[model samples]
Target: MWENKIDINQIVEIRAKTTAFFGVGAIKKMADVAKNLSSRGIKKVIVMTGKSSHIKTGAWAVTKQALEANAIEYLLYSEVTPNPTVEQVDEAAARAKSFGAQAVIAIGGGSPIDAAKSVAILISYPEKNASELYELKFAPDTAVPLVAINLTHGTGTEVDRFAVVSIPAKEYKPAIAYDCIYPLYAIDDPALMTKLPAEQTLYVSVDAINHVVEASTTIVTNPFAILLAKETIRLVAKYLPVAVKEPENLTARYYLLYASLIAGTSFDNGLLHFTHALEHPLSAVKPELAHGLGLSMLLPAVVKEIYPASGEVLAEIFEPILPGFKGTADEADKAFAGIRNWLDGIGVTSSLKDEGFDEYMVDRLVDLAFETPSLDGLLAIAPVKATREAVRNIYTNSL
Candidate 1:
């Protein structure tokens, strides 16, 4: 797929920045990694964690022990909220700066880790707030070195260089990406995920599959993204049901973790199209809607709208995973139908109406989606240009 994009000797960067340490007992290595980063003058570390499961699972206790073992002083911020806001990041950065933090450790899921990355960036600009860092006028800055002890099997933020934050005042939730924001390393321990409830597994697995399919079908896809995406699709289809039905299955948890990481890397390279672009506002406006639920409600609609561009291609890819799927005259629609059926089979039944969206919210959602630059940006790069009518139709159809 990438052969035509480059010359024989030209170079292109393809993988994520963070090196993942996969499997059980990975957290034990956190102390060693922190000590190594400290050799470069890092002393005090800011650890981004939440007040919930990190305490119950003993992840933070281990982290505290690690830091103390390394003779490192640390500050703990447990206030990271889901769909982290710019205000939270700015607050965390201020606290980190006050502690004179030299490095950062994000323990738990994507929300805290995403906040930590932003905190890492804002640490250097004590004179500026985190909101300023996302603005075009502010020059891009490097982040303090960061590491991740990821607890969830979703939101591959652990291995990727993107941080998403909601700006309530602006009605925007945009993913902020730059070179310096990637984690220095990731500890991906499936054991940490064994206690996740079945519903949580389903929500996150839906999120993973969305990343894979959207990346593969997007207009700007590269060879690396395609390979990673194809494998991700297969992995999620095979393992997600197991994860949902048997949350404590170590093998299922391991494979699901791998799928999320692969999907994250693929999307990092290929980027997302209308699904993510449209899905963000559903949560930004509702606040209570989980991101994965929003994606479940919105992705099929976007997929149905865009299928004509690569329907048969998608049909072939999903054939093995989708039961009783066969190419038809309307193969694209069939492909989408197969996906919808698969979602139903796995117990996902989210929709705009079922999720509390009404006719009045349609215009509001569209406008909010447009507020995200990526929506219009994706239209520019999409195989089918999302006309004003098309964009409106995508939202309305989902309703």
Candidate 2:
């Protein structure tokens, strides 16, 4: 058994592009965060979040109290939802502009944080709409300051510059990664994550797992990504089941939150490939589908096809679950089988068919994969050539 070495009792300050505080009581730093923002001439701010995660998790009271204590003015935009739409961001940006919000405070998971990033941009440039920003019609060079109070153990938008927004009308879900989008201040308090439902817990950790897997094996793979990916997988393998079984286990939540953060940093440095490229379209079409579940459904098939190109690196990273892995091209089956079994053991056994997809949708998904903006960029980085035939075969095997 692995020993617990992380000191979750002490707040650790992570200084990356985004200054982050992580630990049990990290949310208490909201006062300091507010004061710092206030000192920066940011008197009026916009708080962006999902419908009720902030209130249900008790993060809202603390954050509101902090802003009030600092004598800062704030407006709340609570319409963000899972797979946040471009319209939601545009509306929030318009409201923030009308309120003269000088900065943005995003509280919740990736959906709200991602929306907040786009809102910040639109607030700065009232001339551009969400579509213009997302479609890259205009390259935004600056945005209003952002503070992220992350409430989940996945989707490391807290510390990363990437954000994903969807246009369900057009079935487009693309990602944006700009240096300006990194939050000015961020908090990840696992205490807030204990109430996350079991399925979401599993799905979010799966998202983190996907982050590292793609980060470690991409064409741009590097030592930093490899090291972080190995630890990310190790922590998720050890702690995800425990967190699922014991929902209020702080230690389990602590490590999983750490896993998610480093996983974010890993992919930020090393980039991603097949899984994200394909999963975006799935969730884009089926707005109810969780991003993590979509990625899990496609992972085994992707690993099978891509393993040969980076077998040694992948084998080392997945060694915990895929024991006795030989890191050879011939062991591709073992690599994917081990991953598939591990996913099943973790209660993520859903097939694409179970998610209301069928063979009929395969062709449409394939076209979306190729047509979606920024996805071709992801596919271009696959270690193996991502030909239409290869993409079609992977989707067929997934089904």
Candidate 3:
């Protein structure tokens, strides 16, 4: 048996750097926030977004209205996709450079916001490409300024400085953490999420739940972060189903958004484990699979896999939200089943096989999980060591 290696009473150092504007009709404050930007040398900005959701949900109109009202000349770039690729970020940088974009307004879900942050980084270093930016080829003197409008409740891209960039050519997806990518300010309006579809709402909420699970259980665990994770899980549990059942429930949307934000803060301080490490490769390889969907499919298996070493407080953290959950040796197994069942209750019942995963690709997924240097830090921080055979077994089980 693995020794009790995690320090349950570890000292905490929390770092929260983003300034946030949140409430109903919060998007209306964009003009005022942009006006604040002019004092900091921000003139023109790029409004980065996905293709249809903004238009379909009316978020695009609010974004444009804000820029125009402030006379903040902005370019609207709507090419972002789920699991945003490095090449796409490079394209956004090119647009920003051409338009002389002084700041970025990210106005969608995690993908667009993540792409916007990466674009801000690539623009600050005009001579380098996105890949080079990832390579840290040059030290940036200053980050290109940014404001994020979070239109989704998942990923918490608005609250953090990390950007997940994928390279299709090599099937690589790596998270980039730099001070420059942190939004100077963020707008998270629950009103915006009211129009979101049930699938998106539930899936993203699961993403937040997954964040709490992985962050709370990592070897870098801390008491404060676990406190945040426990509350986050409780909030997600109470609010997610209501949000799914009633998409227009502003109360549920507001609290779920808060849950995601708290989860982001927790993970930022305590970091993540191999659940996220394992999912990044799935999205990198498949591209069609959404991040949250992949997490839902993999979390049950992952919780069971890591339970042997990480189960001490997991039951306590989970019992508050998981149905019929008991804090025992089998608590991890029960918790995993409860979470998987809860996901099904919210209409997230698809497996990796249903998402086009093949058994033959297990080796590829395993290689990316254990072999990719981009994912090494997360795996290293895992409560249980991630071995080749172990990772392979997890991948196969997830299939």
Instruction: Indicate which candidate wins on lDDT.
Output: 2
Q: Work out the TM-score per prediction.
A: 0.92, 0.98, 0.92
lDDT of 1 at 50: 73
Q: What are the lDDT figures for the candidates, one per model?
A: 0.77, 0.92, 0.80
Write candidate 2's Cα lDDT for 180-287 as tens digits.
899999999999999999999999999998898898888988999999999999999999999999999999999999999999999999899999999998999999
Off by over 4 Å in 3: 1-15, 135-141, 323-327
Off by over 4 Å in 2: 1-5
Query: Residue 102: error of model 2 in Å?
Result: 0.7
Model 3 quality (TM-score): 0.92
Minimum summed lDDT over a 10-residue window in model 3 is located at 6-15
Model 1, residue 28: distance off in Å is 1.5
In model 3, the Cα lDDT at residue 301 comes to 83
Choose the strongest candidate by TM-score: 2
> What are the per-residue Cα lDDT tens digits for candidate 1 across 1-399?
442342322212224588877766666677777678768777799999877878876788888887787788999999887788889988889889989998889988888999999888888767877667654336556888898889888789898888887877777777677878888888887778888887778888888878877777788888787787777777788888888878877777877888898889988898877777778877788777888878877766676777777665456556556545443435556655667777888888777898899888888887876667445665566557766667678778777
1-399 in candidate 3: lDDT tens per residue?
121352312322223788877666667677778778876767799989998877876767877776677677888899999888888999889989999998888888999999998888777778788777654455554678888888899888788867787888877787777777778888877888888888888789888888888888888888878998888888887878888888887778877988888888878778887778899889988898889999989988888778777776677667655645445656666766776786777789998899998899888898877654458888888877778877776777777
